[model samples]
Target: MSKQAVALTLTDLNADTPCCPPIAQRRIPAESAAVLAPAFKALGDPVRLQLMSMIASAPDGEICVCDLTPAFELSGPTISHHLKTLRDAGLVDSDRRGTWVYYRARPTIMRQLAALLTVEAT
Candidate 1:
């Protein structure tokens, strides 16, 4: 990863290129790696990754906790813990409505994560 690899731009994700020149092309910057590592960490778990995908791909842009809990075989508290992990990572947002809690995806961070992982034409 070189300095250039660390300096991500919107066009990197938009144009005909991968995100960066590739870790092989240069050295990865500590700052860029630090900012992106958490996102990868958050997704390292199968449960959390599934939860993130579920929330991100939700039909109405959000899903209820009740809905999420029943979809998994894990206990309620365990699911809650995973959801909390995502929330703390700035990946999801939750809110209560009546008796149910609903969660929505945070697209900004998702986009940022996608951009950081991109490779370039070079």
Candidate 2:
């Protein structure tokens, strides 16, 4: 048996770009799935999922690492690791300000993920 390797290219998950009509509306392409699976995988963890919600729901559209760290019992490094996972998955972005780092949700990817899971009532 021969195995064929698929070349993976980064797919822009920008909010302005329409990723797909809808998961229910049409079939998702394999390439698109390859690009998007990582995001879902990143959120598979309970800690990461809660972190995403916090960042997304932050009043100022961003939250400081200090604010985020205290919310969980985990240590600073554990929280930072989760934040890094989110950043790597393109679900969030962080900026360093003074002595603190702030994280903000990427609306484009959030919208895309929401749309993918949206199911119209029949």
Count of backbone clashes for each model?
A: 10, 0
List the candidates' TM-scores in order.
0.75, 0.86
Q: Which regions in candidate 1 have their CA more than 4 angstroms from the true location?
A: 1-26
- Residues 39-120, model 2: lDDT tens digits: 8999999999999999999999999999999999999999999999999889999999999999999888888888888888
Model 1, range 1-122, lDDT digits (tens) per residue?
A: 35454334333333454444445556766755665566678899999999998999999999999889988899999999999988866678899999999999977667766755567777
Best by lDDT: 2
| CA lDDT scores, all candidates in order | 0.76, 0.85
Record all residue pairs in model 2 with backbone atoms less than 3 Å apart, i.e. clashing. Answer: none
| CA lDDT, candidate 1, residue 116 | 58
**Candidate 2's error at 36, in angstroms?**
0.6
Error of 2 at 93 (Å): 0.6
Model 2 stretches astray by more than 4 angstroms:
1-11
